[model samples]
Target: MTALGPLPPTAAVRLVKEAVQDAYADYGSEASRWLDGFTRQGGQVFCGAGCFGCCNMPIRLSLAEALIVRDALNAEKLAAVEAHARQVLANARTAPDEDVYVRRHRLEVGYCPLLDRATGQCSEYESRPTRCRDTFSAFPARYCTEGYWESLSPRDKRQYARDVARTPGTDGELHYIAPLEYLSEPVWEAAAGAMDRAFGLQVWGDFWVLVSLSARPDFMAAVEAGDGRAALKAAQAAGLSHPMILEIE
Candidate 1:
């Protein structure tokens, strides 16, 4: 057999790109299959594409998700995202951690920042978190937890509250409903880590901070400054789009 030679740098880069693309395609296919199954089992559950109910909430995301959003933003978008993040950071500093849950629930009544008011759809759908992806309709058997709640029955709700207390990450908010079981935590975490490594640290941290900061107005304004396109890119890179906060104010 002929001896193999070292590949050129350009060829290697192309190979890596192909590999990444393949992996993404495979993972996306799997995720789509799972979502399809979940949707089917729950009897055709959908939040409606134009419905912005979930976008208005102060949803939490893993660091990797943050990076994906940041990378999606160009220079202008990066600035906007950063400014929004700072605003959120300011608010988070004063608010009691428990109170945040309450605020998140009420936010559904208001407009969401990422929402396109005219369309009622999230502007950034591709980069949304797994939590958003996994949310299913209120079907008990097909869905992960059908009647697991505190709102339906007082005694059941109280018991659920006690159970949540024992569970570290479980939230006890009025509109807060989780679709998946506890085991999903590790799976999502691993997915997030893989995303982080695929992107760079700068992209990841910027996305994380911006989403966290979208609750603040002052910061978002900073992002909205400069050339509109440039500002949008900067804000997006920083995860700083907080027009929703301004609307509420």
Candidate 2:
């Protein structure tokens, strides 16, 4: 078998970023077509500006996406992001499990660190990750709130079903949810697959974790030199090895 070697870190990073950007563009076109189909079928989209209920959830990103986001931030914003990432990592360490950790992170943070509190907008709106751009609520926007769903009991769930059944345009049908994962998962998979094949390394993780690691001087230097193992070690040292690391298959 021929031996495979890593591309120079700079080249690898560039390839990954380009692949992800291309994937994003493809996703945009696919999502638009899907949404159009949904609308044609009498489905209505309720997501709009100022509706940030879904922003509190954990967001995963490919290395390429993280690098793009990191590069777009100014020094002050980068510092804030680093601080927030540290807190997130700390919380991740103490939680009983991944689910518990994610829920706690949502409740504690209440919004993405990059979110503008006053405007309820992403600071890097134009360059926001694909996951963020793809998220949309099929039901009423209020139901999408973290607190609202977390508070739901069995009875509440039943009542919600009843209420949804009664709502106009939703009779016996699912509301026009964004189908975020359905649409984007393939894009992510393709991007990850391409990166892995190109770099001979796993290359997917939480957005903040990846972004934080990309900011490390040594980490980037190692990556620039096409040393995947060294870059992975740097990420591990920074406490980003958990849920962030995807399966190698």
Candidate 3:
């Protein structure tokens, strides 16, 4: 391969978009293959279409990925995204750090803004962030549910093991989603690298928050302007997201 240096700003932006898209598509394919092989080796994956248990958590995304999500939304959905972003920011104000925000915010806020409460489904499944895409439960759906794991008694744990043993092809132990995570990291790295080159920084954070910011024309302009500092300033000015979440560097 030929050695390469930086491209023009516009070209870099386009490449980042492509990188994220490729990452999304690539993970889907690899996940399917991985699940197939694991299942063939007696692994059971509990992730089904209607299980939105993991949807309540904060999803992190880069500016490019967030923009993809933003473009996928309609006006009403965008409104919901902004509303959810505001809630995240509000809740974040009290929390001293991202860990606190993540732990407390999900329980307080509940359900992703993109989730349809009526049915446990992502409203914008196709355009979901890479983090959301990577979510596959190795444990039971209840594991994803808040307080479910804590509520489980010792007997309940044994019972679950027994049930897994009884179930065909399962080995009475949790399956691993690490392979999927392994696959997801590179995509994000590619996206982050692209964003760094194009936007002069990799601005990323909570999914809804970043998506909401990406929907802003001013924010997008700042990002595309290839000035990282200006983009960071615009992110702070939004006042709808916490710096901890809407990080720019």
RMSD of each: 13.1, 6.3, 7.2
Q: Which residue ranges in model 3 land beyond 4 Å of their true spot?
A: 1-13, 96-99, 153-176
Best by lDDT: 3
TM-score versus the correct structure, for each prediction: 0.48, 0.81, 0.83
The digit string of per-residue lDDT tens for model 1 on 1-249 reads 111122222332233233433444454666566556756665334345665444434545543344345444444444545444455545544456645633633342233345578987766777655555545333232112222342358886676556545432234432232434232455444544443343222112223353443323333333223123443454445444344322111
Enumerate residue pairs that collide in model 3.
none
Prediction 3 global C-alpha lDDT: 0.74
Total backbone clashes of model 1? 36
Q: Highest TM-score, which number? A: 3
lDDT of 3 by residue, 61-148 (tens): 8877876777677777787777878788888889877677777776887788778888888888887888787766667787777677
Which has the higher lDDT value, candidate number 2 or candidate number 3? Answer: 3
Worst 10 residues of 2 by lDDT: 1-10
TM-score, predicted candidate 2 vs. hidden true structure: 0.81
Instruction: Show the lowest summed lDDT stretch of 10 residues, model 1.
Output: 1-10
